[model samples]
Target: MKIGIGSTNLAKIEAVQRVFSENDEIISVRVPSGVSDQPFSDEETIEGAIQRAKKALETTNADLGIGLEGGVTETPYGLMLCNWGALYSKTDHSPIIAGGARILLPDEISERLRTGEELGPIMDDYCMRENIRHHEGAIGIFTNGLITRGEMFSHVVRMLKGQFIYRMNG
Candidate 1:
């Protein structure tokens, strides 16, 4: 099957690649999230994922499209970093949505996020490294590498794929 992923980011792409079979053709394309760069709510983040999935499917004209989005949502305790994944199937006009892990952001990061700063750049600066988002991600830094950005998103993709298979079979 031909699958298109709605991001050029290596971590997100790696997440999808880890879930799908080797026989499937994976196409990575940069697509707009159709939302704020730093989505601040669960609703916005999921919307971004769905939009990316649909846009990627259209852009690549593939049978399926996948989207992964990372954002922060405000919780009672603090701002929490959240990740979401979506799969859109052209044949059935169906979509499977799943979410991964969430970690409370430190005050320093939350404070910067509230100032309209994006997490990727903040994490990069905080880690004193470049392209952390494309690699380990904030979750990795927070978890001390226990859960990487790609791994978290890959878990979500696994859920999405499993659910999609169930739906197809039923």
Candidate 2:
């Protein structure tokens, strides 16, 4: 089966690669999330993932398209890190959706995000590393490397794959 994944971000692509079979050909195509560069809410973030999956499916004409999106949302506990994933297929009008773990952000990082600065650059400067988003990502940094961004998204993709399989069978 041919799979197309939206976005060229290594972390997102890696997640899809980890969940799908080696027999399935996975390719990355750059596509817009159709939302804010930094999604500030769960609704927006999920919408972005869905858009990416739909666009990738159409763009590549692949049997399946995957989208993984990371963002932050405010909560009573604190602003938290959130990631969402979507699996879109030709036979289904609605895509399979799933979400990964959420970790509370430090007040310092949350402060920066509230000011309208994106998390990618904020994390880069906080860690003094460039392109952290494509690497370990905010989840990795916040979790002290215990939970990687790839692993988090991988779990989400696995859920998407399972649901899609069930959807087809049932």
Candidate 3:
């Protein structure tokens, strides 16, 4: 099968690639730009995914098109990030995965986040940390590399992948 992903995020692309690569039955995987980066409600997220997937399908004419949305939410314990993936195809079927990770933020930083600034940029601004993408994220700065955006996101992606399989088979 040929899969077209509606995202160019390296981590997300890699995670989806890993799944298809292992399957071997999948012939190809492609990542293309999708909807803009902005806050989206759960329903809007799914709708956006569907729209992106449909557009990708029309543009690439691939066997399958995947749209993924990455976002953060507030939980009782802390903040959680999730990657939601919607799979669309004219041939086989459709699937959706709402999986992610969680991390607690410092009250101060959480205030900043509430105002719409991300933890990464805030860390960069205050800590004078340059290009923290490879080194650390907002949470990683105070935790001394305890967790990273990439690490947490990778776990979320893996969880999404597992859900994909279950959806496809079940």
**Candidate with best lDDT:** 1
TM-score of candidate 3 on Cα atoms, chains taken together: 0.62
Task: Tell me the lDDT of model 1 at 74.
Answer: 94
Clash tally, candidates in order: 0, 0, 0
Could you tell me how far off, in angstroms, the CA of residue 139 lies in candidate 3 after the best superposition? 7.2
The ten-residue window of minimal lDDT in model 3 covers 24-33
RMSD in angstroms, all models? 0.7, 0.7, 4.5
- Write model 2 residue lDDT over 29-108, tens digit each, in one string: 99999999999999989999999999899999999988888999999999999999898998898889999899999999
* Cα lDDT of model 3 by residue, 1-170, tens digit: 66666655455455556556654333223443344343333454556556656655556667666665554557676654434556666655555445444456567766776787755566678787675634555445656778654555456446555666676688
lDDT of each: 0.93, 0.92, 0.56
Structure candidate 1, residue pairs in collision: none
Name the better of 1 and 2 by lDDT. 1
Estimate the overall C-alpha local distance difference test score of candidate 3: 0.56
Show the colliding residue pairs in model 2: none
Q: Residue 147 in model 3: shift from native, Å?
A: 6.2
TM-score of each: 0.98, 0.98, 0.62
Ranked by lDDT, top first? 1, 2, 3
